[model samples]
Target: MLALNKIRPGVNGLAVIEREVREPGPGEMLVRVHAAGVCGTDMQLYHGAGAFAQRLKLPTTLGHEMCGTVIALGPEAATPQGAGRVKVGDLVSLESHIPCWNCNACRTGRAHVCPNTRYPGIDIDGCFAQYITVPTSIAWVNPPGTAPKLAALLEPLGIAVHATLEGRGVSGQTVVVNGCGPIGLMNVAVARHFGARRVIAIDPNAKRRQMALQMGADEALDPTAAPPVQTVRDLTHGELAGVVFEYTGSPDGVRNTFAMVGALGDVRWCATPGQPMDFDFGAWRKSRPTIYNIHGRRLWDTWDVAAPLVYENHIDLQPIASHEIPLADSPRAFALILAGEAIKPLILCE
Candidate 1:
C-alpha cells in the first residue's frame, strides 16, 4: 500500500512513498483509509517548526484527522465498560492522541495529557495510507448516514465544539475570531450555531475573510488594512468583544487579542504560537479576562458533546475544505497549504 510518508525532517522532506501494510497488533484494529483532513500542525511539522519537529520520526505516514472502515482486528481488540465495542465494518474517526492507559495521568482522569503519549502522524505511523493500525480503544463509531467528508472532519470539528462548549454561554454576546484559518472559521460557525449575537472574523487574507462571512461571521476584517484593534473597538460600539477566539498564533494576533477583547471577556485559544509571546500583562491586569489554552478536544468527552450536532446536521463544515486531493498527491497538497493558497485540504485515500 502507498503512504504519504515524511521522508526526512524538513518541509522538503515530505513526499509520497510506498509501504507494506502490517497486521494490527494486539488490542488494535486495522482501518482502511477513506478520507483525511490536513491541519496546521501538519504544516508546522512540515516546516520543521515546534517540538513536534524534534519528536517526529522520519518516513512516517503523516495524518491523524481521518475517517475509515475497520477491516480487521487483533486479538481481544476491545474491552468495554458499557455496550460500545470495536468491530469490523464500523465507520469511525480516530483519536489522534494515543495514551498509555497505565500512566498516572491516565489513571487520574487526565489521559489527554498522558506522560507517555504517542500521537498519530507525529509519534507513530498515521492514517495517510491505504491501511493503518491503531488502538481500538480510541476509535469512535459515527452515527449512520454520515457523509465521507463530514466523517473526515469530526476530529477537527471536535476542536471547535470543545472550545465553544467549554466557554460560558456566547448567547447574545459579541465574539471575535482573530484568525480565519480552518479551525478559526469553525469557531465562527460553532459560535453562530450556539447563538452568539455578533461574530467578527479577523485575518489578512481576503479569501479566508470571505469564508468567515460564509461561515456565519457578521464581519470579516483584514488586520493589516484597518487598524484591527481600533476597528474592532469601533465596530463593537466600544463594548469590545465578549469572547475572542485566538487562532492566528502570530505574536501580533496575540498582542491585539488583549486589546480587542472587553474587560472580563474570555479568550479561548486554539492556535499554536510557535515562540514565547510577549504578552502585555500590564494592560491585561485591568481587564482581568479569563484565558484558556485549549489542548486537543477533551478526549472522548468532546466526542460525546460534538457527535450529536454533527450527526443531526446542525453544523455545516463543507465550506472549510478549500482543496480536495488524492492521497497520492499529498506533496502537492502540502505545498498548497504551506503556500497559504488553501485552507483545509481534504485528502481521499482508497
Candidate 2:
C-alpha cells in the first residue's frame, strides 16, 4: 500500500511512499480507504507545531477525516453500544477523536472532551493510504449507497453541527461566523438550516467571503477592508449578533469576535490558536456572554444529526469540497490549502 507520511521534522516534510498493509489487530478493522480530506490538523503537522505535532512518531500516515470500505474485522470487533455496527462491505466515516472508553468523561456522557483522547494522524497511524487499520470504536457506518466523497466529509461536517447545536441552538437569532474556513463555511449553512434570523460571515479572503454567501450567509464581510466588529454591529442595527461562532484563531480575530457579540449572547469557540494571545476580561465581563468551548462532536449524538443533513441534501456541501487529488499526488492537496486556493481537498486513496 502507498501512504503519505511525515518522514522528517520541520516544514513540508511529507513523502508518498510504498508500505506493506498491516492486518487488523484484536477489536480492530482493516479498511480500504476510498477518499481522505486534508484538514487544519494536518496543516499543523506539516508545520511541525502544536502539542499534536510534538506527539508524532516519524513516518506516520497523515489524515483523519476519511471514508472507506470495511474489508475485514478482527476478533471482538463488534461495538458494545449495539449501534453503528460494521459489516464487511459497509462504507464508514471516521470520528477522529479516539477516546479512552473507561474514563469518567466517557462514563458521564462527555466523551467529546475526554481528557485522555488520542487523535488519528497525531497519536496513531491515520487514514491517508490505500489501507488503514483502526479500532472499530471510531467508525460510523454509512448507508449502503452513501457517496464516498460526501461520506468523507461527515467527520468535519460533524464539527459544524456540534457548534451549531451548542448553547442557545442558533434558532431565531442573528449569528456571525468569524471565519470563512472550511468548517466556518459549513457553519454558515448549518446556521441557516437551523433557522437563524441572519447569518454574517467574516474573512479577509474575498473568495471565502463569497463562498460564505453561497453557503447561506446573509452577509459576508472582509475583515481587512472594514472593521468586523463595527460592520457586524451596524448590520445588526446596534443590537449585535445573538450568537458568534469563533473559527479564526488569530489574535485580532479573537478580539473582534468578542466585540461583535451582543450582551448575554453565546460565543461558541471552535478554533485552537497556535500561540496564546492576550484577552481583556473587562470587556468580556461587560458583555457577560456565555462562552462554550467546543471540541469534537458528541460521540453518536452529533453524528445522528449531522449525517442526515448531508444524506437528505438539506445543506449543500458541494462548494466546500473545492478540489480532489489522487493519493499518489497528495502533497499538492496541502500545498493548495497553504496557498489558499482550495477549501477542503480530498486525497482519493482508491
Question: On a 0 to 100 scale, what is the lDDT of residue 166 in model 1?
Answer: 68
lDDT of 1 at 279: 80
Question: TM-scores for all candidates?
Answer: 0.96, 0.98
By summed lDDT, the worst window of 10 consecutive residues in model 2 runs over: 75-84
Report the lDDT tens digits of candidate 1 across residue range 1-350. 98998788766687788898889887888999899988877877788878987888787888899999999998767545113387789898988888887878888777777878888888878888888888887898986677877888888888888888766858889999898888888889989999999999999998899999999999999989878899989988898999998888888888888888899999988888888777878898989889987777776888887777778878888888788899888788888876888989988998
Which regions of candidate 1 deviate over 4 angstroms? 80-84
Worst 10 residues of 1 by lDDT: 75-84
Looking at model 2, residue 235 earns an lDDT score of: 88
Residue 49 CA error for candidate 1 (Å)?
Answer: 2.2
- Cα error, residue 74 of model 2, in Å, equals 0.6
